[model samples]
Target chain A: MKPQSMGQAVLIGLALIYLASLYFMSSPVWMGFTINALIVAVVALAWNITGGFGGMASFGHAAMYGTGAYASAILQVQYGINPWIAFGAGIVAGAAMGAFIGALAFRYGLKGSYFALVTLAFAEVLRICASSFAITGGGSGLQLRLEPGLSTLQFNDRSVVYTILLVIVALVMALTAWLKYSRFGAYLIAVRENEDAARALGIDTYRIKVKAMAISGAFAGLAGVLYLQVWLFIDSAVVYGSAISIEALIGPIIGGAGTVWGPLIGTLGLHLLGEGAKHLLHNAPGLNFVLYAVVLICALRFLPQGLMGLAARIGTFRKKEDDNA
Target chain B: MLEVRNLSKSFGGLKAVSDASLDVPEGGIVGLLGPNGAGKTTCFTMIAGFTRPNEGTVRFMGQDVTGLPPHRICALGMIRTFQIVQPFAGLTVQENIAVGAYLHHHDRTEAMAVARQVGKRLGMGAMLDRPASSLTIAGRKRLELARALATGAKLLLLDEVMAGLIPSEVSEIVGIIRQIRDEGHTFLMIEHVMQAVMSLAETAYVLNHGKMIAHGTPKELVQDPAVVEAYLGHGAAARLQEGHHA
Candidate 1:
């Protein structure tokens, strides 16, 4: 089998095992933890499109995520639109925002740290606007009226939400897998490797970057809609916070930046570690973040390529041992 | 197939390429030669659309492509190689070539196939799976040429492909260039190797101080007093003229 197909098989098998384990778990607490972790995984996977593949590290993905959440929430609260329609609108809004930012930054040749700061500024401006605007419910935030049903996108059962999140994560994983081997993905990698060379080879690198950003934004927006539906409330601070943006990119970095399964592995490990630290610290206010900082530092120091690189190294070592035998 | 007229470029007060022009007829090998800091690269960049000329026009196959971007010009069947080899370091040799193959083949399998074909043709088939960063300088140069060929370019602008090669390696490249030219591809090369340029190019243009000083067949160019003066000093040119008479 091709390496890509083998990877897909492994991902699908892991997903099946995860769903089975979730089905057997009776505790709502564990279920909630898994759901939240999976949500982070999805967001990180989306962020990888631009951050990892396109080599345009964005520190303000929270802006896209929050725009998605708020776009859905405002439509539902103001016009009583169906939640499903509002969710679609949120994805579109996120893509539009991504294109606007991409065009402005790329046109002016803003890159590296400057581009990252611009993205951060965009999120901060959006957060401030959302907090001050009356239409966005001001600082008080918007709370969706919970009408329990699949049609309403609200359910009494936690597993329903868990299953939906799992599907979304799975779809994102599949999309990433396809992108890893596609022509467009090659173009994105070429652009990332050497922009001038890519252009000389007949690639319009600007267009490719913008397209990757738009797709990334759309996925982030979808994650936001999922967050809103499950949590039933979203304040600007919660959705548009810098922490969300940081979390989106950190998972991929801690797993393996450019690999398909990196974000999922990274998110699961980070979230589980955070939850364990929280338990040990008696749910202390900021200790989880402190633990995250320590783990991030260690990951950067020892395993700069993340867990996937570690796994590959181990695999090679084992193969060498077998050859010696 | 390619025409550059009255091209000029200035980096601030320094004129990099001033009012320089050249042409490559279909299926011809054109050599661009100059001493250090002679603006051959600047002229090539303007023709390939990497840099806009201050005052000039670039016409490819009768279409004015003066201000078009590099990618657009490449899509119009003209491509240029870099002086410094850029082989996507993180990718495998085949994958690096596949990046250029992707321009024509949207399918990954097809692109990879083209990459394999190009790799074999360039004598890099054995290292197809090796990382591009692992290649030697000669290997990297061949990989660069393979990548340019993968783009299916009708007119290739090669910048110093023979700069650092040994005589044997240079001859190998000369043979490859001749084979490629025989297959009906046109090349405009910037070469410091006079023997390779003289052996390959039917017509040659000499640049001195950002200006076109002489143009002729390689044999004619070697005997030209002006060309010799630009390359060696006036005293050397006079000595060469006396030696010729003797």
Candidate 2:
């Protein structure tokens, strides 16, 4: 509202863009794509806290994602609870998993590649558990009864879901933006860059890293809740699979590793490219992975900092230009 | 004031710092001079609480702070710089300083203001917004020092800050160190640059093979025969004068 910082302007711009795009697109296909983009944005923003800023690369984000999905799905399917309340339950479950994993890994001195391996192993274990557990519908999966009521988080309309998703995406963006300048964020960056240096300066690297991991997990859980509401059904393939983890991990990396708004931009652009490639490579089944690989390679080779880094540079350049005039 | 009692550290079978003890008076520069691999850095690490001493007590003020974590020690008004410059490469020069300011202030505005003030004092004000990776070696050294100073630590442990500096830059750093000391900040500095140590240090400690071989004023240290034999080449004892006044 003050119009002093770039953050406010960027946030307002993102909201406006989401709203304008919603107005322009009337088809269910467009609505589905938009929701997917928002979901990816939420996951990427969650991943950024630990993987990007904290420099703790995780390949097992599916553990949190699956836990969230299952928690909400189970609550609604068995307990006759509303999806809205079940989402909160999912967040709590995800937070618990995050804290447990973060504490164990940090306390035991597991880091870098080993830490990533631990996360990956946890995700695989979760996937196997979901496949075997009766509570989660075993290998068959559980489907929620669609109670079409405002309180049940069920709307027989795509637009209502899309609108809710837009607000969630914006909220996630604003939270990450706030974190970018917080003391905890600075501490995390310091810990990520050099743990020894950060410690020498009196920053508790372990506690900060664990906190970041927990927060990241909670956001992933939130994303899971939204995903469940949209489809009103959950299965291990849709929730606990490695594919979901890969999608969550890659979205942030492709956009920008640690910058605000990177995840959203990366998700939006990648989903659009995915759709376009489906038409262009109608027969070549492997073209999707090929396109992703090419983009990753290009991003690593030329723009290692990602599009957000480029945009920041251009923004500063424009400011200098304006000053000169 | 700072005191190290029976401080010792061993790696494998070799004792890097053995039974070393020294007391640095408050609000004055004390030089630690030793040859390479003489346990000077090992002692600094132990005192700064980066490494645990095998058998030692590091007392600051009147507190028995043995084996305290580095940040906890820093919060109690003690901070040390590494021998090698380790600036946060992805962050700007000001942001690097802001990380240090994070210990004192929570608000970004106040922390940045403090960072700018410290940057200006350290002659890094102009390059505040520049990426840390872009700075020259001497500039990185300044950023390191500025960051340490920003933590509001009462006791500063500087490890060879003048190691890779040109003559003019060394002089500038010496002036700043002197100014910082004059402002009532205590310092325990390790330096191989004899000129800066001889000029700035009020008291000097000489270490050889992880032991405090000699302790006196810089002039007295120059005349210690044992110290001369340790540093001055064989049959080059007469050239010690040239080394001292160089």
Candidate 3:
């Protein structure tokens, strides 16, 4: 068997084992934690499309996330639209927002820190607008009517929500894996490494970046919709807060940026660590934030390439040992 | 075929390349000879669409592609290599080459096959899986050339590819360039290595002080009075003449 096929089979087996384990976990609290972690993982994976691969770090992904949440919530509460259709609308709206932001940033050559700042500013503007807008229920926030049904996407069983989150994260992982091996993925890496050289090699870097951003925005928006459906409530502060952006950034940084499994591992590790700290600290209000900051600092200092780099090194070391043997 | 006409560019106060015109016919190797700051690289940048020309037109395969972006020009079958090697340091040598091959081969497998072929041709087959950042300067230059070749470029603009290489390595590169030329690829090279340029280039153009000083065969270029004065000094041209006779 070819190595690629063997690798694929191994991945499939691992995924099956993970799903089976999740299916057996009966604790509601643990399932809720898993669901939250999975949602963050989805956003982080989406962020990686632009930040890690496309080399355009954005600090305002919350804008798209908020757009998705608010769009879905507004459509359902005000217009009585079906929850699933509103969810789809949110994804499309998020993609449009991404395209608009990408077009402006890339067209004007706003790169590096400037591009990051532009995205941050964009999210801040959206937060303020959402806070002032009556249709979104202003700064007090919006709440979805508690209609517990699959059609409404509001589930009475916590396990159902967990399953849906798992499916979404799995789909995102599949997309990320496919992108990591695709020709377009190669182009994104090239652009990230060196834009001029990529251009000389005939890669339309601007278009590639915009396309990646659009896809990233769409997934982030999906995460937002899922968040709303599960929580039944969202405000400008919760959905479009810089905290959301920080979480998105931290997951990829801790696990590994630009790797397929990095965001999932990173998000899971981050949430578990945060939860452990919260429990040990006697439910301190802001202790988890302090712990996360320390973890991020340590990760940056020691594992600059993140955990995936360490794994890659160990793999190489094992291969060397085998050769020597 | 590549034709650059009336190309001119200026930085705030300095004229980098002024009214420089050059041409490379089908299947010919043309060398652009210039001293430091003679605007050889600037001229190449303009022709390859890395920089916009202030006043000129770059006609590639009979299309006026003066202000087009680098990728557009590359898609038109004209690709260029940077003077300072710009390898995708994070990627392996094969992956770096595959980036160029992706222009023609959409399938990852086919692109990688082309990368391997280009790597072997450029003597980088053994180091295909090695990170490009780990390669020596000469290896990086070869990688750059390999990448350009993998793009299936009909017209290649190579900027100082032979610079900073040992004599043996220079000779090897010259041989590869010759082989590529023999395969019917047209190249416009900006080179400082006199011997390699003389032996490889069928025609040479000399630029000095952002102006074209001379254009002829390599032997004829070296013997030109203006070329010698611009490159060396006022009396150096006389000294060169006496040395040549001696």
Per-residue lDDT of candidate 1, residues B9-116 (tens digit): 999999999888899999999999989899999898888888998998999999999989999999989999999988887688899999989988989999999999
Mark the regions of model 1 whose C-alpha exceeds 4 Å error after superposition: A1-20, A316-325, B239-246
* DockQ of predicted candidate 2: 0.50
Report how far residue A164 has shifted in candidate 3, in Å: 1.3
Residue pairs with colliding backbones in model 3 are none
lDDT of each: 0.87, 0.83, 0.87
Tens digits of per-residue lDDT, candidate 2, B55-170, equal: 98999998988889888899999999988889887788899999999898999999999999999999998889887878888998899889998999989999999998999999
Residues A1-325, candidate 3, lDDT per residue (tens digit)?
1112333334334545655686786877877887888888888998988988888989989988889899999999989999989999999988888888999999998899999999999999999999998999998999988989888889999887887788888788888888878899999999999998999999888999899889999988988898999999999999999988888888888877887777777787788889999898899997877898999999999976677655555424223222110
Docking class of 1: medium
Question: Candidate 3 chain B — worst ten consecutive residues by lDDT sum?
Answer: B126-135
TM-score of chain A of 1: 0.92
Per-residue C-alpha lDDT of model 3 across residues B41-140, encoded as one tens digit per residue: 8998898888898998999999999999999999999999999998998888999999999999999999999999999988888889888888889999
Question: A1-325 in candidate 2: lDDT tens per residue?
Answer: 1222354346437645855677676878778877877886787888888988889988888788788888999988878786678989998878777878899999998998999899888888888888898998999888878687788887788888887887888788778878878888888888888888888888988889889988998988888877887888778878777766777767778777887767777777777787789888784775766787788788878866666655554434223322111
Give the DockQ of candidate 3.
0.62
Where does candidate 3 stray beyond 4 Å?
A: A1-25, A317-325, B241-246
